[model samples]
Target: MQKRILLSLIVLLGACSTEKPDTVSIESQDDMKHASSVAANSTENREEVSLSLLEKSDSKYSYKLNGMKFSSNDRVLKKGSVVQSLSESGSGLIKGSFVVIASQLPKGVIEHYEVNEIATSTYRLIPLEIGGDLYELYQALRQNDVFSRVEIEIDYSGKQTSDSF
Candidate 1:
């Protein structure tokens, strides 16, 4: 048993020799900190956004702006920044974000609506329009249903899935 234990110790000592390999070290061991700092600075120019609605429009007011937010308490109000409809801008991945509400309605049309966030500068590129199906939207407005479901894409921090069943 003693001989067996000695043999195992000899094998273990042989495996863990202090000899260093001749492989190349790109930088000295302590230089990794400098490399990480350079990398961090290269991609750290992100802008922080405060969550605030900048604009809102519907059929009622003709592009009036006083920088006011919407409220349910007011029965007769005008020109609030709440972006009631969805606006489309950009191509491909950025297409689903940004929206313009009620900018497409005919002359002198007035309604109520909300606005969404300014997630990207892409919103500026999209032509403003009331977001919905053209035919059904016309029917609903004629039928006197003043409000419609507004669709807007936000930065939903979750796994996205296809709508196909």
Candidate 2:
């Protein structure tokens, strides 16, 4: 009787452990699927916004911005001259970042902006000045009809000029 009771207890414990692992595996798989779906939706939304911007500009050009390339049909705008704008600048400190003043953005297009992540619109400010290469980006954004204003923030407080005695 004692041996039978011990065997039954051991079997029940083993079965419970195995069931827990399967449950965890299923939950993890579901989480991964949900994440993938969200990522796909985000990309689709961005593509839609890009297409609409191109339509609004009525340009015939292809350009790459933020690692994504798209084409437009407006001849007046130069190739690789336009960048999509974001609504809210991202969180964190940004030193010497470019500020893009543009017309009202389309709905469902606003996203967080990261520091030094090239975008037409950003609101964060930092102490460091922007790099020279980004000047071209700034120019492109400024020239685009979508943006009414584009300029880099210059933090003058850090500059120390010495006069010769």
Candidate 3:
């Protein structure tokens, strides 16, 4: 009786297994080809822009790259200049420190920075201090050649206030 039961279980498991040929639908193949073509065209259209590093200064730093002001350090940046340092309040709905997300995990990140693994690609960076200097930290991360891309987190809450209009 036990042998019969075992045979029945084996048959049920075998029936449940799904082993089929690795075949994709025609529509899926066409979609993949279209995506590759679009990617190639977009890459051909992209133009490279370069940024030059300025002299090292202790009393903050500022520069205009492609007409965009990059202000760094604790010093109060000029009006309309892009502030590189982490800000508590300025323009965004949730104005806070700069959050750095890399395409790949970077090495030797500052001890103060906390790394939260959202997924294989996504990571959330949080500092112990709200006023931590993230711009400097970002520059340090950029120097490492291992990371593909590192950028600040932009707030896109889509909350419309009176000032927006």
Number of colliding residue pairs in each model:
13, 9, 0
lDDT of 2 by residue, 99-158 (tens): 655545423223323334345554332223223344454455556676565554433233
Q: Candidate 2 regions off by >4 Å?
A: 1-94, 106-132, 159-165
In what order do the candidates fall by TM-score, top score first? Answer: 3, 2, 1
lDDT of 3 by residue, 54-100 (tens): 23344556533222344455343222223442333333222333344
User: For residues 7-53, what per-residue lDDT tens digits would candidate 1 score against the true structure?
Assistant: 99999999998998777455775677777776776645221121122
Using all chains and alpha carbons, the TM-scores for the candidates as numbered come to 0.20, 0.26, 0.35
Residue 109 error, candidate 3, Å? 2.9
For model 2 the local lDDT of residue 19 reads 45
Best by lDDT: 3
| Best-fitting candidate, scored by TM-score | 3
Report the C-alpha displacement of residue 79, candidate 1, in angstroms: 30
- lDDT against the true structure, each candidate: 0.33, 0.45, 0.50
